[model samples]
Each structure stands twice: as structure tokens, then as C-alpha cells.
Target: MFSATVLWLLLAPAAVSAAPLTALTDCLTSSAVPQLLTTNSKYALAIKPFNLRLPFTPAAVAQPTTVAQVQAAIACGVAQNFTVTPKSGGHSYASHGLGGENGHLMVDMKYWTNVTVDSSTQIATIGVGSRLGNVAQALYSQGGRAISHGTCPGVGIGGHVAGGGYGYISHTQGLAMDNLVGAQMVLANGTVATLSATENPDLFWAIRGAGASFGIITYYKFQTFAAPNSNIVYSYNIQFTAANYLALQNYANTTMPAEMNMRMFITSGGLQLEGIYYGSQSAFQAAISPILSQVGNPYGSTSTMGWIQGLSNYAYMSLTTPIDYDIFSKSLMTVAVTPAAAAAFVAYYQNTARTVSRDWYLIIDLHGGPTSAISKVPMDSTSYAHRNALFKYEFYDRVDSGSYPSTGFSFLNGWVASLVNARKKRGQKADGCKVPTTTFGMYINYADSSLTADQAHNSYWLTHYARLSAIKKSVDPNQVFSNPQAINSK
Candidate 1:
């Protein structure tokens, strides 16, 4: 048998090092795929990460237009013993789109952008490079349809949907992954596989929530909902006060409706609420009344908008909508925030906001209700484990556009610990019952760059981690598709 580095020795110049990167470069050189090496000037712009903090340099960037070229890139990575990762929108919080580390193979999926909807079936098929905004526009224009997705118009649908996408309408519809009918991906050994409920069922389950760990999805087919053209959009600024804080906490724990989706921003300075009500102004008034009555009302306004306008409105909090500010974020999913935990959180937040030289905030989005569509999804149906979460909180702190402060993570880290620890403190009472501290968990989409492989698998997948590992070992025995947080084969 020939050596794996045989091509490296023959094709690569004598000075080039091994692990056969030189061989991989040579293989890509001959393939139809558009290849950009580190030496190339445009490689920097092409591989520029959305999160500037986690920087990386790949062995080469492969921009494949056709299915076969994508296969070709994978085959080359195999021969050269290089790690391969797909770049959909480059919006990974940990910059996993750039391979999350140096000297790996980056498959830039920018050229495969296509959004086609079947007017008859109302099922939409989208390509890997398609952004959320473009997908929403196509869904609305093609068939007056929509899907539950994130607000960032620039986020790539591949990663977003693969990681359990959610938005304001998720309570009414479901997560973006819940909409998927089928998906097409290229596996580690240059095998192109199409997955759905009946086809490659096991792999389908793995990719739906933890897709980035397994393979590169080429496109997705989703069930769509009739686009909501007439909707109520509201914004409010509430004064920071103890009464207001407790009132909002009680309100969050109970009383939210399925049709009324909301997210609140809490900081050391003040509090703001913004979201949509998929109903008329009068109905929205009734839905929002409980919170307003308790908080004693503050500065706010409301307006009606079509589906298109809402996407533009979010463009989500550093991310225009104050943070639209953070260079880092910690996401937590919980069934409910107990009264004690809430009070502890507010007190800590208020106290920290004044002392910390840096700025931080929390965007807690309501996702649970008696009739919430998200909760109805069975825990075993998809790889997404947080199906029953009542709320998803993303904690963020602003780090300016430069090298991240070496010791900058302390504030949010302590903030998360405070809430988790406080949850069990005094057996936190809520609705006359003690709430457990183990309920809240970290999220996968808001990937933290600081976690280890085991920590990430446990944090993101929880009980589903074992099955995902077994599937990873079966499909990707060599582990071609991976990043720092990627699932390891059992």
C-alpha cells in the first residue's frame, strides 16, 4: 500500500512539512473547487471570522459550487489528514466557521446560495450560504410563508437551523430546526447523504441539533407557515427599581401567552422590552396588560408591521438592536426562574453594573407557555435537548474591536454562577414550590470558546450526548468534520 503522504512527497516541494497539508493543497489545486491558500491575499477577507476574538488561519479555503466539488474537498482533506469544517455565514460565536483553530481545512459555502419554494406544497428548500433575511424574503415572496428563525439577517441558515434556531415567533410556531423536512450533507469520506425522517434517520437526528459536529449540510427543506403580514410591534423602557424588577420576574414565571413573544434587556443602567404580538393591537393590549399593570407602566410605543419589516427591525441586540456590543456571550435555558434566583440575579446585576469598568447585559426571551408550539415537540424527536425550556437567556459583555482583554470573562462568568447557585439557595420558592438549580443549562448556538470537548457535549446535548457520540463514531470514524467543541467519537 502507498503511504498517505506519498502525494505530499511527490507533488509538494521538498521544503514543505508533513501531515500532508502540502498534499491536500496539491489535490485541491487540481479539483474544480476554487481554492485560496494562506499565501493568497484574498484568503484573509474570505476567512475573516464574525467574532474577531477567536482568530484562525486555515491550510486553505475551498469554495465549492457543485456537490461533486464539495466531495472533492472532503476527499482531499482525508488524504492529507487535515481537519475540515464548513463555513455557512461565519457567524459562530466561537468562530467555529473558521475551523475554530489554526491549520485546518475551511470549506467556505458561500457559492451555494439558493432559495426555492414550492408554491403548491409550501415547502421551502434553501442552500447553505443563504442568510436568514434572504430566506425570510424568499419564503414571503414565493408563497407568503415563513419559519421561526433568528433576527440577524446575515446569519447563515445552515448553522442557524442546524443549531435549533429560535426567534419571537417560536412560541407560536417552533424552532427553525423543527421546520426541517429534509437535509443534504457531505460526509467525511466524500459520501453525499440525504437525510429526513425516513432516510438515514439516525444521522438526521444527529445533524438537526448538533450538525456542525458531523458533516457539511448542502441545503435544507423546511415546512413553512403562512406569513403574518399584519402584526403588532412594541418597545418599552422601564425604570430600574426593586418593585419593577420583582414584578417582571413574577410576570416572566407566569402569564405569558403563546402568540405573544417577548425579550427583555436588563443592564446595570436600565431595562427595555421589545418583541412582536402576532395579533391585533386590541388583542396585544390584553396580552401585555398584566406586565404593564404590575410594573406601573413606563415609556413605550407600539406599531403594526408586515413580516418583512420585523426582520429589518431585529438586524437583534452589538448585534443594533445595544449589543448588536458583546465579543462574548453565555446562554442559559431554564424551565422557570424562581423568585429567589430572580432577586439574586437582579441584585447582582445592579451591583455589578456600577463596579465593573466594562458593560454587560442580558436578553431573556420568553419561549414557554401552556400552548407553546416549542414545548409540544417531543424531547426524543430531535437532537435539540432544550425543547421544554421556558426561557432562553443570553448574557453578553462588550469587548471592543481589538485583542480581547485577557481577564475579561470574569464578570459574566460570576454572573452565571450567581444565578445558578442562587437557584438552589433557600430552596428557591416559586408558586409555593421549591425549584431545583439543575434546571438551567448552557446553549449550543451561543457556543462558548472556553469549554472543553466533554464540557460542550454535556452542556449542549445533555442526555442526547451519548447518542450523538455513537453516531459520530459510526459515520465519522476518522472525525474529519470537527472544531474545539465538536463531539468526540465514543
Candidate 2:
């Protein structure tokens, strides 16, 4: 029992300025779906973004339980000229799931969580609302199968795979997008289409990476691989001093094997190197011997556990603990780490650790080993453009609500910019390694809102922008599905 007049006033400046709120509300309610209005007590929680920096109050939140209901929601929004954003797990760094700005309709897909595995084909048909943890558990329980996805279990598969999902095993198995075989989506015009490399190929390519701007993905069919033997994985955690930063980078650049994945962190406690190997304990020990030789007598720990257990351990999540929404993130893709760049990074880390609270840290992910299979695919085969990077660097900080840093957000921004600049200037080409790189590109899943429109377009899409733009124009001519970093159909 929401008042249309009040809702209209709340959405006065929205894109659907001319549409009647009463008709829009009636259209949605007639479907007998669960809907939350601004007046509803649960509305606030429903619209909350993972990153609190982009707070938004949507006009209404629709929870569609069936594909027909999803179609109804999208059609109603279209007829009412309201923006419709599909939200799953609500994890967009910029909170694009909240419509990026206020007064739009949020189609929350949480009720659509379903994971079915075809034992014969070893394929997983996953709903857009399925989180990585649920999908993994379901797949592992039903059949010993797995998909290469992100580290965070709470991350939604829809957006994750849409933006080229990568995980620890990605170095050997390829990204989540690489395993995507087909998808069913609700387009801007409210039509349902099943797409794959053989059908609606261009749209298939576009949705693989630039999906947020094209349509609402309802489900994905991913090729699954047999789970690791006995679900056992070998992992190691090693601590290092500032002096060993360059040495660690050199090891990652040279001796690190494709069978293993390494992640380095600059934490307040100290610099830590965490690694995971998809092999036996003996193989892992032999693989990391060179690294151990360089950092003699360093503090380290190793363990062997089930794959799911490893994911849970790395995510550091408990049943009662929720992910922190009061956070900011910035990211860049690099081909190589140079001695000069490594030294500068250490200096920046020391300075930031002293200036900021203990909550801030830097994460450097090792990419490109057997993952070159990703590059072997034709560039135009999919919309995910960052196929050449050797590693990815991410800067994460906890910021006070509604208040920028004392020196301003620019302080954090400047640090990221300077570090990227240094890496670009002194780092060697990422070519000649297992990974082939002719240029540079950024990961779109780690979308940075601080980037200008032009910068985001160039960095995320790179050479694929023009083609993606064309597909966007063709599929969503009105640009119904969009966000701050979305592709421009026009």
C-alpha cells in the first residue's frame, strides 16, 4: 500500500520522469511478486551497497522468483521508463546493483539461487543469484566438479563471470568466463534470449565481459572440471621483511610454477606471501624450494585441506560475520614488477601503514601461467579484454562514512596513480613469459568509480570498446541496463 504520488515526487529527476508511478506499481503488483517500496521497513537493507561510498535509495525493489516474473519486472520498468538494475549478492564495488544513482527499480535476484550439475556432461547450470560458495558446495556435493571463480564466497556468479571471474586456480584452469558456454538473459526490450558462441554470437561475446550494460543475465551454463583429487590442496603462508620485497618479486617473475598461484600482501604486521598449489604436498614443497632458499629461516606455515575448506579459509568469513561495506578499492593490471617499482611500493606501503589505520592493505595477485589458454582464444571471441596481464594490483582502504580522508580521497588516489606510473615506467614487458602481452588493460570486475568516463572506457574495454559499443547499441538501444561505468549505447 504505497502512495504513487509520494513515489513520483521521490523520483522527480529520474530518467522515468514522465511515467506514472501508479501504473508502474500496479504492473509489478499484478504479478504477485515480492516487492519492497520506500515505505517498507526492509527497503533500506534491500538497497544497501557492498561499498557504502555509493549510497542509493531505489524507487522500489523487486524480487522475482521465476523467469516470467523477471520478464514482467523488466517490461514494467521499460513501459514506465524507469531504470531497471539486476542485483545479485549486491557486491558491485560502485554498487551498480543499486542503479548507481537513486530512483530506479532494483530487481533483486536473490530468490533465483539454484545450482544444478549434469554429471554426464560435467556442466553446471547456475542461477544468477547463486553465490560462489553455494555453487561450489552444491557442485562438490552432487558431483566432484568445480568452476574457477573468485576467492570471495559471497560474490554473485552473475556479475563475477560477466566481468571475467578469476580465482587461485585460474593460473592453471583459466578464468570463470573462459568456462562459460551459454547463458539466458532478459534483454532491454523484455525479450528472453538464450545465447552462446553458436547463437547470437555477438551478443554472447558482449555479455561475457560488458554484460552490465547489455542485459540482465538470468542463468549461466559453465563447463565444470573434476574437483581436485580427495579435495586436497596445498597452501603456504610466508612472512618477509621490507628488504625481501624485490627478491619476492624476482621469484614470482622467474621461478614460480604454473601449477601454483601466489598472492603477496602488504599488511600492517608485515609483508606476507600466501601461495596455493593444486598438487600433492611433496610437489608443492619442491615447487616452492627456490622461494624458500631466497628467504632463509623466514616465518612460514603450510597446510593441506579440501578445496572448499581452502576457499573458506582464504575468504576469512564466518557465519555471523558480514563483509564490510565501509570500504574503498582501486586496482591496476601490470605486466611485470621491476626492482625500482618494488622499492617504491614498499616505501608507499610503509608510509600508508603509518598514516592510515591498520585496516588498509595492498594485494598483488600472480596471474598468467597455464592461463595463457585465455589469450589463445581470439581477442574478439569474448568481451573480456584484459587477457595479457601478468599480475593485478589492488589497493583497499577503510574510509569513514560520509567523510573523505583528512587529506581527501585524492590522497589515496594519488598513491595508486603514482604506483601505477612507476610500474609502467620501470617494469619490463610482460612478453616472453608464459603470458603474451602486447599492451595493457584493467579488470572490469574491479570497477573503479574514481576513473573518468573516458578513462574507464579505455582501460576496461581497450580494443573491444568499439565492437562492444556497437553491440550495446543494437541490443539495448535505449540503454536500459547501465551504470556509472557502463558502456554508452549511443
lDDT by residue for model 1 (105-158), tens = 899998778988888898888998988887888788886888889888888898
TM-score of each: 0.89, 0.87
lDDT values for all models = 0.79, 0.74
Clashes of 2: 0
Pairs clashing in candidate 1? Answer: 317-324, 318-323, 318-324, 318-325, 319-323, 319-324, 320-324
Judged by lDDT against the true structure, how good is candidate 2? Answer: 0.74
Model 2 stretches with alpha carbons more than 4 Å out: 1-19, 31-33, 230-255, 295-297, 319-321, 370-379, 399-408, 423-440
The true-structure Cα RMSD of candidate 1 reads 6.9
Question: CA shift at 167, candidate 2, in angstroms?
Answer: 1.6
